[model samples]
Structures are given as C-alpha cells and as structure tokens.
Target: MPSPAAPAHPAHLSPALTLLLATATGLAVASIYYVQPLLGLLSAQFGVGSASIGLLPTLTQLGYAAAILLLSPLGDRFDRRRIILWKAAALVAALAFAAWAPGFGALCVASVAIGLMATLAQDLVPAAATLAPEAERGKRVGQVMTGLLLGILLSRVAAGSLAAVAGWRAVYGSAAVAVAALMPLLWWRLPRFVPATQAGYGELLASMGRLWLQHAPLRRAAMAQGLLSVAFSAFWSTLALVLAGPDFGQGSAVAGAFGLAGAAGALAAPLAGGMADRRGPQAVIRVAALLVFLSFAVQAVAPASLWLLVAVAVVFDLGVQAALVSHQSVVYSLDPASRSRLNAVLVSGMFVGMASGAALGSSLLAAFGWRAVPVLGAVAALGAVVVSRHGRRA
Candidate 1:
C-alpha cells in the first residue's frame, strides 16, 4: 500500500477551507460551554449551592469525558458527516431540555445530555485535519482552533451578559436555535472519507488502553495540558466568587468583563501554532508554563487591582491557550485515524484537571482565603515549568 501522506505547512491550506472549518468550529464549540456563565442564574432558579452549581460544569465535563471515551471511536468506524449530524441533532434536543428544565435535577440531566452530544467537536477536529492537505494541517488546524478558543473564552462573557438580560434558559434556547439551523448546512458541507476501523464500542474503548501504553507523547501532552488547565480553572471558577465578595463586592456583569478583557489570551493561538510549526511542541510547553506561572504570580499581588488582573489575564490566557493549541497539534500528529479517541483522552483529562483546580481553589479560599489562591496557581504552573525543563512534563 502507498505510504500515508505527510502533514502539510500552515501556508499550504486554501483560505476558503480554513475559513469554513473556523466558522463551523465557532458555532459547534460554543454549544459545549454556553452553560458556564449561566451557572449562577441556573442555581438561583433551581436553588443550589456554589458546590452544587459547580456540578453544572463538573457533570457537563463528565458527560464530555464519557462521549470522548465511548463515542469518538465511531468516527473511525463510520461516516463522520453522519456522526456530526446526529450529534448536532442530539445537542439541539439536549439544549432544548435545558431551556425548559423545571428543576435542578432536570437541568443537570440536560447539561449532561448537551455535554455528551457536544463531543461531535471531537470528531469534527479530526475530520478537519484529515481533510486538509498534509503540508498545511497545522495552519488549517490553527484556524479552527482560533474558533474553538474564541468560543471558549467569549462564551462566558457573551452568555453571562445575555443570561442577565434574558435569563439562562433564553441563552441556551438561542444556542439551540443556532445549532438546529446549522445542522443541515454542516451535514451538506463536510467532506467525506472512508472509515478506518469498524470496531464495536467495547473494542474501540479497549484501543484506548493500548493507546495509553504505547504513546508517551500522548500521555505527556495530557499531563502538561491538564496542569495548565488546573491553573486556568483556579482563576475562572473563582473570579465570580471573589468579585462578588466583600472587598470587590462586584456583580456578575463586572465578573463577566474579565472574560472579555482576557480575550487577549486567544491571540496566542497563531503564535503557538507557529512555534509548533518551527521549534517543536516541547518548546511551546516550556514557554507556556513560564507565562502561566507569571500570570498566577501577578494575580497574587493585584488583589484589588483591575489593571493588574487584566495584565495577568492576558498572560494567563496566552499561556493556557498556547499550551492547549500546542498539545492538540502534537496529538494530531500521533494518530490521524483515531483522533476523536485521542481527543477524548486529552479533553477529558483537561476538564478533570480544571475541575480539580476549581475544587482546590474553592477549598483554599474557604480555609486560607482568596489571598492564597493565586499563589497555588502560580505554584502549579511553576511546578510544570520545572517538570518540563527536565523533559518529563511534556
């Protein structure tokens, strides 16, 4: 058989294909996170605690993990367009359920459903890379990645503002409408390729065990990204709590502004993509860890300083986004045929990392208070930097 084609340079992609995937990524990835900024409102409507409101993201993440672990292999076994289409439809249903949810219990169920359905993005990214000309895979993937980052960072601000005005259900309802409208277009526009494996779900999941044993890079990327995510989670998950507290005593609108100001973080995608294109992904991780460490350190000093928070947000976002993009770039290089499964491993690990960090930050605040939280995050990134320097963190 002919050898598989080599991956291409960023400049190799046609602008049209890159733009299409980027647009689709913005729409699809946003669906997965529309609930993040709405958690406060959802909690009020259902009457839950911070830790319980925490479960909104936690359960959604768990559902995402399950989909990646269980469903992503189908991309290798079946037609990807159909999988994307079906998952989008399922997502619409889930979002609708969330919109009309009557109580906390129903909301949790809907969030899980949405999380499971939204893993279509896992399949979508692999499909984008697979369809790209080999030479431009990184560039093309970077374009889509910009959309992913934008959706992730902006959704908090966007959803928060919209949630305040129209209510959380309205925010989800609007997304559901957009997702439902886009499904047919996606089903039509996506490219086609033959499936690589027809393994059953059990067999596909078993492949992950083998994957874990064989790929050192995959494991390392997961660790590096996971730690970086924990650092990020430390800030985002508690920003509202701190802002809403006595010192700042700010409202959600103020808290949401941080998300917008932090948009600078997404700017690093191109830089990270370029770095991975040149020096190799390890270099990107090293720099990202250092930046993340600085971001946390800056926050430690800037307790009531908006300007300082903004500066740190920029640094922190750059570190997190760069590390994230670089991590995905590495994983894409490893296995072209089963990226969804690989994504399942990587994305789920990231959420768990964030969840762990968020939990840790909350507990620290409860005991040592908010002043101590940034120090913990700084220590996390610094620790990663040390580990990376030794060639162990990856």
Candidate 2:
C-alpha cells in the first residue's frame, strides 16, 4: 500500500469526490479542537486555573502550525492520498493517548500530537484545489472550508455534550472512534494525487520561505488571515472562561451551545466565494474585515447579555469564514503547482496568530474579565482591515 499503482495526476474530482474531501477535511480538522469546550472540565479535573489551561489550545495550534510548515509541504513531494491515510492513522493513536493521559503533562503532549496529525485536513484542501477546474476552484474551496469550519464549531458542541454525560476523557475517546471510522471511508473513496514537484524534503521545506519572499499577494493574504485568526482565537479560547465565571456560572455545555451561533458563519462562505469570483477576492476580503470589526463593537455594546452574545458570535463567525474563503481564493489561484505549499504558508500564519490569541485572550480574561476580550479582538479585526487596504494599494 505504500506505493500503490496510480495515475500521475488523476481526473478532476467528481461531486461525490468533492463531498468526500469536504467531509474528510472537516473530520480531520475537528481533531485539534474537541478539547476546547471541554477546557473547563479538564481544568477542574487537572486542578489547573483558566489561564494555565490556555496552554492546551495554544500548544495544539502551535503543533498545527508546525505540521503545516513541516508536513503539509510533503504533499507536493509525495502522493497526497497516501499522506492523508497515514496521517489519519497517526491521528487515531494520538487521540487515544489524549483520552488516556494520566496527568496534565501527558495530556498536553498528546494534545500536541493530536494537532500535528490533524494536518491531514491541510493536505486535503490543496488536493481539492488541484482537482477542481479553475473557474470552479473558489466555489470548491469554499465548500471544503465550510465543512472545516463546521467541524470546528460542532466539535465544541459534541465534546461538551459528551463530557457532560461521559466525562472529559470520553470526548477524546469518541474522537478516536470517529477518526478510525473515517479511515475506511477515505481509503475506499479518496483518489491519488501525484507530486507536482520532484523536490527533495529539504528543498520542499526551503521553498516555503522562498515562496513567502517571492509572492506579495501571498504575503497580504497570509497577514490578513493571521490577524483575523487572532480575533477568532480570542473569542473561542476565552468564551469558556467567561461562561463559567460568576456572571453565568454555566458549565461546558453552554460553551458548546454557543457553537451553534457561530455555525451561522458557515452560511457566508459560499456567498463569499461567489462574490470573490465576481468582484475579485480583495473586494470580498474588505467586506469580511469590516463585518468582523463591527461584530466586536456590537459585542461591546451588550457585554452581559447572553442572547446578544450569541448574536455577536454569529456575526463574528460570518466575517471570519468569509475572509478565510476569500484569502484562499486569492492564494490558490497564485500557483497551482504550489497550492499545498502556498496553503501551508498561509494557514501556518493563521495558527501562529491563533496561538498568540489564545494566550492573550486567557490573560485578558483572567485579569479584566469579558470586556477586555472584545476590545482586543476588535483591534485584531481592524488590523486585518488595514492589511487588506494596504494589499489593495500594492
């Protein structure tokens, strides 16, 4: 199975294949996030404070960032389907270790491994782009991204609800089972993708730096996504703390329920893709940035209202998802041969920003409470807008 007989480059993805990629991307990405809403429960179980537990999400994202840099580029040098299958197997093992970790240190290490293996989704994204027609590329990427975002949002809900009934470890256990189940589906349906580059591992890694230096539009797209990621991470990373605090006194389930609100953002993705197709990605990105910036301000207006907070979640998610699709549309069109490496460079920045945001959001919530989160997130969203504006001029 290591070197299966396959075409140099398979035919374009059928709609069924496209749907498989979207579902696979979603499931794979979800592995890195199942612990989010479970953060409160894990904190109590591990005897850690809110601020300290932030390392869990931060380290997970850092691990993901590292995978994007180190592993995602390998897709361009090897068969992508093989990469996805082997990574999924590794992810199953990582999830099981996380479910059975005996201490905080063990759990933290497992979390990092889980995140690293979750880069299978990164592999699939570019593979999808490679299999689509240029005219349909944006739409296809948008659909895949919608699945990815839904996985992230729904993961919280599933983890929280499962933890409420079965315990924190149960969430990870279920995740392991889900990934194992997905393996057979992918093994049967996923098509092989030949390497576009004959570069060795060393050269593949080196080219990412060169790609960054060579492409200005790539730089703009990456910077904008990174800044927006800071805001997105800020909200999700801190929401559990805020809900469990004195005002709400709710458990993890409440945090998970809020994910439903954010799911509204998924609706904006197809629209953003179509808009990017019609008016250009930059135009769509501009609107996305403004929406995110405004969501933060609206959040500040009703800091203590739960229903209003839910509405803010919806608006913010919409903005973030829209910008993400637009950004991918821009960069994916830059170089088809470099799609995996390009996406690796782009999303790697976003994860770094996510890690930073998680750490920053935790500190702010621990110190000043909920009010500070929106303030900081707004600043980050506005930074994205500035980057987009600059990109327009350049």
Candidate 3:
C-alpha cells in the first residue's frame, strides 16, 4: 500500500523554483563526475598505474551507492529542505578537501566523501515530484533531471578545460567555490518540506524492503535501469583511457570535449518524460535500450575511429538518459508518499551498476583493449533490453 499521502501541495511548481531545483541538482551531482575526464592527468600526477586509477571512480560510485541506500530515504522522514542543506554543506567541504589532497590515498578518501554528500541531488529529484501537481509530475521531474544530466555531461567538459589550463587541483577548487555560492541562494529560495512519514529511521528503512517486494514495477524499473547504467558507466569511465592510448594519442581536453556529444543526449529527458506522460514509459524503455545496444555494438567494432565513437556516444547517451527518465516515471508512480525511498532503491541499483562497470571496464581495458570496453557496454545494454522485454509492464 502507498504510505499515507503527503500533505496536499500546490498543484503546480513555479518556474523559478523549478530552475533552482534543476541548478542545485546539476551542481551537486557534478561533483562525483568531475574526476572522470581528468583520470589520465590524475594517473600521471599521482604516479598510479592506469588500471589503479580506475579505482577512484569505482570507489566514488560505491560510496554514492552506499549513501543512496542509507541516506536518501531520510528525505521521507525529515524535512527534505533540511536534508538538502546539511548535505550541501558537507559536499562543499568534501570538494575542497579533494582539491587540496596531497596524495592519491587522501584523494580517494575525499572522493568517497564527495560521493556521500552528492546524494543531495537525489533529494532534489523527489522534492520536485513532491512539489509538482500530479498532471505535471513527469514534466517537472524531467526538467530537473535535464539539469542533472547536463551537469554530469558538462562537468567533464568544464573539468577537462579547467584542468588543462590551471591543473587538476584548480578543477576541484573551482567546484568547491561554485557549490558554496549556490548554497545561500538555495536557502533563500527553497521552501521547507513537510516530512512525509513519522516512522523512525529503522522502520523507514524496513519499509523500503517491503516496498521492493510489494511492487513488481519497482523491481523491474530498478533492474532495467541498473543494467543500462552498467553500459553507461563502462563507456564513460574508460573513455579517457581510450583517448589517451596510442590509438588516439589525445589528451584530457579532447576526452572532455566528448562530453559535448553526451550533452546532446540530455535533450532526451524532457522529451522522454513528455512521451511517458502521453504514451507510457514501457515503450520508451524498449526503444531506448535498443538504441544503447546498437550504439555500443558499433563502437565495439570500430573503437579506433574517433568520429565513429563520438556519433555512437551521442546515440548511447541519449538512450541511457531517456531510459532513466522513463524508469523514474514508473517508480515515482508506484507510491506517492514513498517516492524518496523508492528513488533510493532505484538509484542505488544504478550506482551499484556504476561501481561494477568502472571496476569491470577498467579490468577489461587493461587486459584486452579499448575494443573490450565497448564490448562490455554492448553486452550490458543487451541485458537491459532483455530485462525490459521479459519484465512485467510498468
């Protein structure tokens, strides 16, 4: 059963609040990804082996998965505004710590903290759903998610360009400053959220397990999205390494520019959301997964061609992101009051897949070659397609 409904809220979210939510989500989530484009530079600076450098992203994703499971559900039991504020402050500090870390080990520790605090972005998504009217929920969530997807894509571009000019430390330092500035603005403009449930923390968590078992749609959404995330993470976590190899001999700046190709994919979020609102998310999932599989398959065969890789990136990123919006639409509709916990379960699965992909992709890239990375992605995308095909309808 749906937990007691949240106190009735406004039927529509204002434009200004929507933009604030989007901006906040984007900036918060960007912290986890800023290191990706800089992996090669970090490898050289920290004197770590290429394969070991992959551990940074792996640890970050692991930390994120842990936090999503542990902390994200707190939004339902407490005022989401308070949770967002507290996490934002910690995120700022973590980013600063990462900027000044004197060694790779310290940097890795800081990366975990960055991931933990970045759950603020996840908080904002449920908050958006809580605020928007039922009729507009899909569109509103899509808008905020567009900010999130852009932040994930553009952070690479920004980090690469900034690191190229001022060095990697400056990239983290600038992120710290940007997030710090946003906090006061968020505080000033964001409204307080009424706690959706009065359950104690332990009961609240227990309820999540009940929710998972109670809804087949929730389980399917999590499984399909998690599988898609494996492909998404594998491609991104290894792209810099691929570009740095003799096949391309490109630098971080060039690898970061490839984020531009992925940015094109962000356009799919609102489109997918609108489509889901009209036609339902299931069809969208099937088509989007196919796009991802095809994109990765092509890249696996022609890994050496930069132009082909860029084109494939655009297609696969679009597929991955579109599927995410559709999955969220399905999950959010599961239980109105349980949106936070449901989101936690869904996104936790995604980051687990991310952690796995980073670990697996790095190992494959090291053992086999760049071709192997996309092959892994192709296989994972195919699995997602299979899951969508076999699963119960959302």
Clashing pairs in 3: none
- lDDT of each candidate versus the true structure: 0.74, 0.86, 0.87
lDDT tens readout by residue for model 3, 1-394: 1123333355578888899999999999999899888999999999887689999899899999999999887887887877888899999999999999999999999999999999889999888987888888768887898888889999999998888899999999999999889887667666677887788989988988999999998888888888888888888888888899999999889888989999887575558878877878898998899999999898877637889988988998889888988898889888977777888899999999998899899889889988898889889999999889876343
- Lowest summed lDDT across 10 adjacent residues in model 1 is found at 1-10
Q: Candidate 1: where are CA atoms >4 Å away?
A: 1-20, 134-136, 333-340, 363-368, 392-394
Say which prediction, candidate 1 or candidate 3, comes out ahead on lDDT. 3
Each prediction's TM-score versus the true structure? 0.87, 0.93, 0.93
* Per-residue C-alpha lDDT of model 1 across residues 347-386, encoded as one tens digit per residue: 8778777767766776676667677679888988887787
Screening candidate 1 with a backbone cut-off below 3 angstroms (N, C-alpha, C), the clashing residue pairs are: 7-134, 8-134, 8-135, 8-136, 9-135, 9-136
Models ranked on TM-score: 2, 3, 1
Better of 2 and 3 by lDDT: 3
Give the winner by lDDT: 3
User: Ten residues in a row with the worst lDDT in model 3?
Assistant: 1-10
RMSD of each: 5.1, 2.1, 4.1
